[model samples]
Target: MANQYDRNPFAEEEEVNPFANNNTGSVPAASNSRLSPLPPEPVGFDYGRTVDIPLDSDRSASQNLKKKEKELQAKEADLRRREQYVAFATYLGLVLCLFWNIIAITTAWIKGEGVTIWLLALIYFIAGVPGGYVLWYRPLYRAFRTDSALSFGWFFMFYMLHIAFCVFAAVAPPVVFKGKSLAGILPAVDVLSGNTLVGIFYFIGFGLFCLESVVSIWVIQQVYMYFRGSGKQNELRREAARGALRAAV
Candidate 1:
């Protein structure tokens, strides 16, 4: 029993087994095989929305300018629409004045009753006919086409010119034919003296002339409100437009 306990088990190894190929030092192929190329990381991701790329400063500014231009064009279109209506009324008034003057002059000449009144009426016609074209038609045409506003100076001058002509037209018949009130065939005297037929004519015709002046003042105000109520940049633009127009004129 003592000798059995002291003996080495199987005398260390039962003869070398040459057929065994088990080598603990060799590693398996799994570690070296290309690690299933890791799932590619995503590029740019949004929550189902397209991303906005950064824009160059100049390009952004140019787009903004185009947007402003479209808006300005729209505003100008609205202004021109109203302005055209006023111009139409002004033109109508001028035509009426021309016809009224011709009729009044002819009536006075036939009767030979109001020489001074006829001559004054002729002068009034001259002022209103051509002056209307120059002051109202051309300026308004340019304003509408150019998308520009008449400055206060231009409008004031025009308004005053009309007032001067209309006041004389209304007041001159009495001044010319003072102390003779019976059968005054001149349209102005007839109107002031309450002649039904002539008074109605003057009311419609000369009333329109006065109306045109009033509306012109209003139109100028509207235009100023539109063009002048903006920033410094737009103010400079309007000023430049005024200069260019003056040169053209």
Candidate 2:
């Protein structure tokens, strides 16, 4: 019974140690001693240590300038071409009008047709209105400003004036022939008497056409000036481009 109790006593008490859970304590300390030293922190960057870039400031500037010059030259060339085209077209139109006038005069002379003359005079007046604005004023104004040439304000003003002139012309014949006969079934006497008023219209229209012609001459001179100026600008641009190219090289 004593032996059995002693055996049981030995089985009842198992040793409980809290320090057994910390088996790596001395091993961690010994391993830390064997570890390599940590790397040092990097100092602040040295900005001035960079290599010098071989940037040719003059060469780059010249290249950019040459590109700009070429663009300007191209634009000027296009403008010159457009100007030549416009000039040629204007001259062609003038020739056509001249031919038209000749034909109208010839027909009127051959037939002694007063109506033809009246019609021609009316056409002359219509043409002269625009011609006056275009030939006399527009070119000189464009020469100074260069921007007003494409503006429609002047054209619009001329159109309004033309309409007013037409209204006046329409009313004048009736006023002139107010008391005339209505005979010949087509207002013949009125139509015939209208010619008397139209005779005055012819004088006015002829004077305007002459003025317009003078203006056209002046406009042509302005166009010539533009051409000359454009040529000089082109030469200067070419020279500038050559200088830029040489500098780049």
| Every model's TM-score | 0.49, 0.36
Write the residue-wise lDDT of candidate 1 on 1-249 in tens digits: 367568676676668778865674694545565566788988866778976766787799999999999999798787768866775665676567556755645454445545665565666576667777777566656655654444333543575666555444443355445512212224444554644455455455555545655765666566556545544337556787989999999
For candidate 2, the per-residue lDDT at 229 reads 60
**Candidate 2 lDDT (Cα, whole model)?**
0.46
Q: How far does residue 72 in candidate 1 sit from its true spot (Å)?
A: 3.7
Clashes of each: 0, 0
| Candidate number with greatest TM-score | 1
Q: Measured by TM-score, how close is model 1 to the native structure?
A: 0.49
Clashing pairs in 2: none
